[model samples]
Target: METVLHTDKLTKTFGRLCAVNRLDLEVNRGQVFGMLGPNGSGKTTTLGMLMGVTNPTSGSFTWFGERATHLTRKKIGAVLEHPIFYPYLSGQKNLELNALIKGADPANIEKVLETVELSDRKQDKYKTYSLGMKQRLAIASALVGDPVILILDEPTNGLDPMGIAEIREIIKRIAADGKTIILASHLLDEVQKVCTHFAILRKGSLVHTGPVEEVGKGEEVVEVIAYHDDLPHILHEFRGSLSVKSENGKFLVRLRDDFHSVDLNKFLFEKGIVASHIVTQKKSLEKQFLEILQETTSHRQPT
Candidate 1:
């Protein structure tokens, strides 16, 4: 896959505070990449540097294998905070004006409007539209130039559930069309649902980066209980078990990725042990996210 964006030791500081620290990133084509973090974790600051709105204190970035410049930025469509439009202008008219500014083809206006599901409301004035409609129009403006890469910051920030869902669907559709999307959001659920790859940032440091699937599939935790009192011995003898600890009168066994609850049960059965209960607990992205934060926090604490 082609790298759409690459950063080398990107750093940004404000007085005594480092908003972004030696951050290295690689965003590939045809990927919906999510920059996930709590508020003030450099998500917006990083995006700002990439979009040229904020100057980096150090480091450099490249777009399409070339250093970031005005010409390079033109190849990317971005909405950092919010979109601005003339209240009196109709949605289509607003997009037309944006197309003119970007030198984009006028024909793409209708296509982008359709993509954002605003074709029906294209003639409606921007101010008269609902909050969701307004957000969609902002996305439409970004698409006016038919850029290959899209960067969004908190796309669903202040919206209700329905509006959030609407934007998510739009993002999914755009990603499906093979556009490289770099989104910064604090919403873990949204990233898990829409992003293929994600990086977790905590206090301006990258704590984790990997495919979304790997985030929640690190290890399988199995809850097992057996009728026999020799459960500890059986657990210790099970080669597939990574670790086993007694919790709430039941054994919580951590199994390797290649092993499952059934595998553990079979191994115990072959050793003359019968488990009365076996439950596999699949990890969630939120859980993994919290764990990463907790681990990083512990490491940062004074010893």
Candidate 2:
């Protein structure tokens, strides 16, 4: 639980607009921390300030318990957007050049290529690789420096399902090796599956922050599907039912405190409703995310 990064009231403004306001965050070593928000919720601006590409208007940050500096920045590697590499150069050659620029040892190039699963295609020209391969190469380039932390913004943007799965696996692999990663993505599913902890940002302010596992832990949620048309109304009228939502031909019934799935099943039996499917489901991250946004809608500032 060593602190790898800390920000104190980090603020950034442009002319009359405040892009980021009084942001405070702490990331620990060996953590895959996710920063989640909409496109204009200051996720990118906060990352820019942390990476030294954009100066902060006020506040400060520290890396490895030391104040931000050139030396401290070297311990981190980042990819803010689509990476650009020489189209004509081979993937291996491109990584060599990147290592030189970062002052990383040339000897680490082969290991990083293997780490990103690009060893077989390392000799292929950068332009010849698919979109997925190009992205893997970018990650390989970032790992060549042997950084303690890696920062990625929208690492799976514009990729197919297969490509997204590949990147997700690679990220999990990196985290398994005890490297700290700060990932900024609007994809709630990605954060739920990959990150240990997450912070939700709304209108440049924090709305919620907590462990992904603890979301909706105390709530009772049950999924049911019945052929009868009156199933929805029946569920709504059931005792202890808080709400019922339909998705993909299934009804998710959330119950009040002390109400269990057994109570729901017993109620359905008494109503003579035969369910075709029934199971308890962990509350999904998407559901929780929407609820959080709805609760904060009135408190949001104009931006």
By how many angstroms RMSD does model 2 differ from the true structure? Answer: 3.4
After superposition on all CA atoms, what RMSD does each candidate show versus the true structure? Answer: 3.4, 3.4
Q: What does the lDDT read for residue 170 in candidate 1?
A: 92
| TM-score per candidate, chains pooled | 0.84, 0.85
- Which residue ranges in model 2 land beyond 4 Å of their true spot? 225-252, 262-276, 301-303
Residue-level lDDT tens digits of model 2 in 1-303: 799989899999999889898898999988899999988999989989998989999999989998887776667888887767999999999999988878899999999898788899999899999888888888888788899999988899889999999999999999999999999999999999999988888767778888888876887889999888889999999997899999999999998989988888889989898888989887888889998898899556454
Candidate 1: regions farther than 4 A off:
223-253, 264-279
Identify the candidate with maximal TM-score. 2
